[model samples]
Target: MIVSKVSKYNTLNDFLKSKTFMKIALSMTGCKNNRYELDQILRWAIKNKVPVVEESEADFAIINTCTVTSIADRKSRQLVRRTRNNNSGLKTIVFGCAARAQKKVFEEITEVDVLLGSMQEVITYLESNISDMKKCDDASLITSGEAFTRSRALVQIQDGCDNYCSYCIIASARGKSKNRPQKEIINEINKHVANGFNEVVLTGINIGAYGASLTTRPDENKFAELLEAIFEQTGIKKVRAGSLGPEFFNEKWYKVMQNPRFSRHLHLSIQSGSDSVLKRMRRNYTAGQVTDVIKKLRGISPDIAITADIIVGFPGETEAEFKETVQFVKKNRLAKTHIFPYSERQNTLAAKMEQVPVKLRRERVKKLQEVADICRSEFIKSQLGKKAEVLWEHSRLSGRAEGVTENYIRVRVMGARTAGSITSEVLTTENIDTLL
Candidate 1:
């Protein structure tokens, strides 16, 4: 099941044009996974006007997928085959979390000529010399510098994870926590700034843990210092960081946030608000610590859009624990809550603990959704009258245009669409689409 051999210096642009005007198509599913990965590839496609044909019309389709859930895995498989059936002779590439999670069987798909994991490698493979693309499980190793779509590129400050959370298989699949050198990060940020990207988000498997293993215990290269250097040295106007953990919070982080250009967005992963559940899930922080951080962020910048990831229904989650989670959100008044039902990933701590019936998991998720809706309603109410910068995106509403507020809220405005332009601000609390 060996796919085509990718050459040593594969770049996505070079790969796409290697075949002479191939209509490349790509799609992504899931939360930040969607925004960070596919957004980069598609943005590249749009910028180059590289004949990135839509799913139905594509000659060579790429699926940058997810494996967060068994259901998500199903969707990835379905999409892979669907693309194959639709374009019978067309070449398809299936990579990303699901592809890795499901074994190297994707190379079995006769129609899919190439499968690369992680967005970082996928981009390189696309532009890489057609012969250099290696069909290996290590997507990151397929390294080649890409121009990205913009000058302000996401310099992956880190990659992989060490925490090994109970329900997540990311650590095993992606491997250990790996951080690019501080100087390397600064250089990339400088490159992005020089290219014209005013903002760069420090990204990785567990970004908040940056500098921990790199420096000695007493004189560490702190995450905060990394931020300071990125700002003071690189002069990148906006700095956003995450998949952060609550344990990483310290006053030094407060010092970094004092900078106005540091985006007031904190994406905290709160699997559940119940303490017993947190212990069972092996999450290091309690609900209170998470709240304290949220409150601190609000005090520092009230407009900060605080987002969270919550997984409901572990092995033996009871109604009381579920209620506690609901009450936790009610008290925290979270700006946004990403709700997920627990999925039993193979070879994880949770899968072996005990099984929560599928029906029960669904019910728990439904209840949490109810609570999340309540929290979102309260947060939106708080956002009533604020001026926020929004990045405009094309719309499905009328094939027109829309934009996203800094806190990640979508605000539909009256204007023509431009792909990457940051447009004017509206002095309204809620966006037009909210009412619709």
Candidate 2:
């Protein structure tokens, strides 16, 4: 059984093309991209008629991993050991951002049969090297690796980050930023659209800094123009962007917001609410500037679901600073907030800097989370009486079930069947999940 498989982010199912009967298991949740990685993997499995399993029930095991957090790095290492342990004889391969970030971690582990970095290189290396396991090095080579992803098909418009944000280890973990050929991006979108995906998300380490590394035209690397080309050329892929920093937003991109297909959701990284802390964390944008973007988004689309990431209790964050964050969130009417207590990661600038105690970080995270819940409650309640076009997804029962609206609201049903499923709009809204 010459089976082929990849870890979590292997979206295109490049390995599936092989003439092999292999059960594949992949997930995107490991790294937490703009789109769900596992969702894309499931879609690919369904399309190719391939079986994807949870543990080792087949010839091989692949893990696409993450290294954003210290915990994430540990999780990746744990999986490599577990996969081999469960199937003691199984051929296990570990790869992805985590693998790239912690090369030494892989080198230390004997369980990992093949170790590589990034989805693109992992695919290319596995294609040639997997046949004879011993010949491949513990650290796999990308060889000018180019790959798209499952989490909204992350077209890597750029890779790595140059911004030496004090707290961030990305500069060391993932190398310098590398941009992709704009033409190739268009081609990939066309292919995915042909395959039935209606949307595509642009992904990168420093997406805000795309096209800077180019030899052709540095000024031509404007994200707005890139988006213009994408929208004008193809109607198939709706532009669902991945992680976008404050540097990415401006008046020019604001004009592009007019496109209805563009998702209203914008995940801005407001790591710290305190202006002083922003400088310490080395985040490029100011608190005032981020608030301005939020305000602008509201003006353009009031219903737009604006999300943000807030790292509570950074080094030197005082009670007043935390309160400032709380006030800012309430004032701006944020739709969602991903709150993280600061962790002192090794080798990063933050680790060496004066640290915020873990207990303090936890307290700050909890307090901010409460603020987020209050805000989200308001948002959900607002949607209660309105109508939306949900995708009409599946259920765990005998018939079809609930799905999300374009704005990304999950409307579940006792069996709240959508409009097309049953000829009852009033019934659907009311929880009378009955079919007739």
Candidate 3:
């Protein structure tokens, strides 16, 4: 049977084009960009009439991997191993940051059949191997117009990053920055709108560096200009941005915050609040600069939810530096914080510095997480009596519905609400929960 199958097809493409039916399963562990890529692959599979099934029953499995942190890397490897174990005959394909940055790690896995380093490679390989594959309409390599799930759609405006932060491996994994054309982005958003998606999140590896690569019509390529174009050109009701660096905030960005359609939540990628730590992290902005940006954002929208990503235990971080971070979180009254204990990545500058003890790193994470919880509760309490637009995402049988506000606040209401319906509700203690 094996000899017959081999003789029937000259290449993988021939087998794909043959009358044989194939099934595939997808798994991923990463950020929004990874999720977006997986969604694009799913769209392609659907277009080709490929059945998506469970890993145990699949002929092939695509694993979108991540290497942002040591934990993420471990998880990525474990996911691949578990998927391969599910079906011994399954062909496993690995891709994304981890596959590119730590190629040998995946290469050592005997279960992996193909390893793609980048989204372009993934797209090219699929297009070449799959017969009669439809090309994506947009200039970007990924397909568009499909909602990420049933609710909000993610529109990738850019990919990769040049900012080599001392502790980040993503820059190396993703390679140089690449910007999608503004018209392509706008058209993508319009497609999501027509598909019944009211919210579209503008996502990228480093969205702050959106237009750095575009030379022609430089004025139109600026990040703020892209935002303005989306507001004016697309029917998207709510536009949310992904994690942004301190450099993203400027006079132009401040002006765009005035738009009613723009989401009120901002997740700043300010790794540390201590200027010394910031310098060690090779961050361009200072602690004071981040404070100023937060203050200005509040001035523009008092009810805005300002969140941040903070690394707790970078190498050589002293108690004073950690306190500064805690104070900064308190002073700014951040609505939420995505906190991480520093994990040293090989080939990065910070990895060579004086290492913080694993125990200490975990301790710092706990302390800061406590503070973040308090700030989150305070922010939710402060929103009481304020009106908010809630996009219902989940409904229960007992006359209960849960959704997120424009400012990213999670709210639950006592009524039958259809998922995907946007409704205005006055936030009260009963409706808003401070747990998130």
TM-score of every model versus the real structure: 0.80, 0.79, 0.89
Best by lDDT: 3
lDDT of 3 at 366: 98
Give lDDT tens digits, candidate 1, residues 1-436.
Answer: 2244454124334545555444567666544534556656765655444555566656578886677788887787778788778877566676777777675666555545677766767767665433443233333322223333332345566666666778888777667667678898888678666655656666666777777773112123378888888778887777777667777878898878888878777888778889899988877779888888888888898878777888877888888988899888888877778888788888898898877788988887887778778777766666667677765555545655676665667777554755445655763653634310
Better of 1 and 2 by TM-score: 1
Cα lDDT computed for each candidate against the true fold: 0.68, 0.63, 0.82
What TM-score would you give candidate 3 relative to the actual structure? 0.89
Report how far residue 305 has shifted in candidate 1, in Å.
1.9
- After the best TM-score superposition of candidate 2, give how far the Cα of residue 273 lies from its true spot, in angstroms: 1.2
Could you tally the backbone clashes for each prediction? 17, 6, 0
lDDT of 1 at 268: 83
Q: What is the C-alpha RMSD of each candidate to the true structure, in Å?
A: 6.6, 8.1, 5.3
Pairs clashing within candidate 2: 7-64, 8-27, 8-64, 28-37, 28-38, 413-416
Candidate 1 overall lDDT versus native: 0.68
Q: Rank the candidates by lDDT, best first.
A: 3, 1, 2
Tens digits of per-residue lDDT for model 2, 158-216 = 77777767777767666777877889888877876665555667777666566665312
Off by over 4 Å in 3: 1-19, 132-145, 214-221, 397-399, 434-436
